[model samples]
Target: MTVGPKARRSGLPARDRRVTTRRVREDQRERSVRADVPTGGGDVGVATDAEAARVQEREALRLAHRVVDLAEDRKASDIVLLAVAGMTTLTDYFVICSGGSERQLGAIAEGISEGLKQDGYLPIGREGSPDAHWLLLDFGAVIVHVMAWPERDYYGLEKLWSEAPLLLRIQ
Candidate 1:
């Protein structure tokens, strides 16, 4: 039988020919494996678009809850979670809560930042002033608003996002 140039030059015996063929087949098999499979490098499981959206929604909801819990822990009141996944492209969830005073608002924001930091999450942007009536923390998938009662009432976020479903409310 005719062997390839490398094999012919190596002058390998018949026994070695069988080993080389097996090695070549193994290499081909490895190369042909699907790319979707996770390679244990922190990649989540492969999913279709719909599945990916659902996963993101689930994660957003979890983050929203975490924000609510942190705010509540800091004595924030009138906590509300709005699921704006389908209604708005800006963010998946909106976590709205009220702080009694400017000091409380700062405390609430700090609590949220420290809490989310434990999960390796940092806000992409923070708007409004901690000393002001409203402070917003944007975490990409979730946006948290720590507002004073008057500001929340005047801004009417609930009215603006009325079409969005209310996922959770903590009085």
Candidate 2:
């Protein structure tokens, strides 16, 4: 029946009346609740660790597809996209493509890099030279291999990582 500040002071035990650390924490938790916060179930604002990882994986897959499209634009031949997340810890996706000649290889590499950079993606590292006839552009989650027909056939990356699923191929 009594419910004012003075009435609230009338308590049973000293232990119940005093504001302990645990009691203060409980009071803060109660006060922090708002319409935006869930009272019981469901999460809000931030994603869980597993969900975040899956989101990152989806981003990597998207990037891989973008690379494929860019390579196709530049007339790359024998394009193959491989999902290597389960097979390798190095990268999530592998984009293997072949060009007719060394000059074509460089164009494929440049086209992929410039196109991705425009969309806010950059290569972490680049490997091989024009003379080598093999170019590798590493973009963190996704890696691109630009090779001449002979080298691509010689290495046989698709055969090497045979366990990985082939997401796409344009021959």
* Model 2: lowest-lDDT 10 consecutive positions: 30-39
| lDDT (C-alpha) at residue 125 in model 2 | 62
Model 1, 55-108: lDDT tens per residue? Answer: 556666788898988989999999999988788767779999998889999999
lDDT, candidate 2, at 56: 70
Q: State each model's CA lDDT, in order.
A: 0.80, 0.79
Model 1's lDDT to the true fold? 0.80
Instruction: Give residue 59's lDDT in candidate 2 (0 to 100).
Output: 72
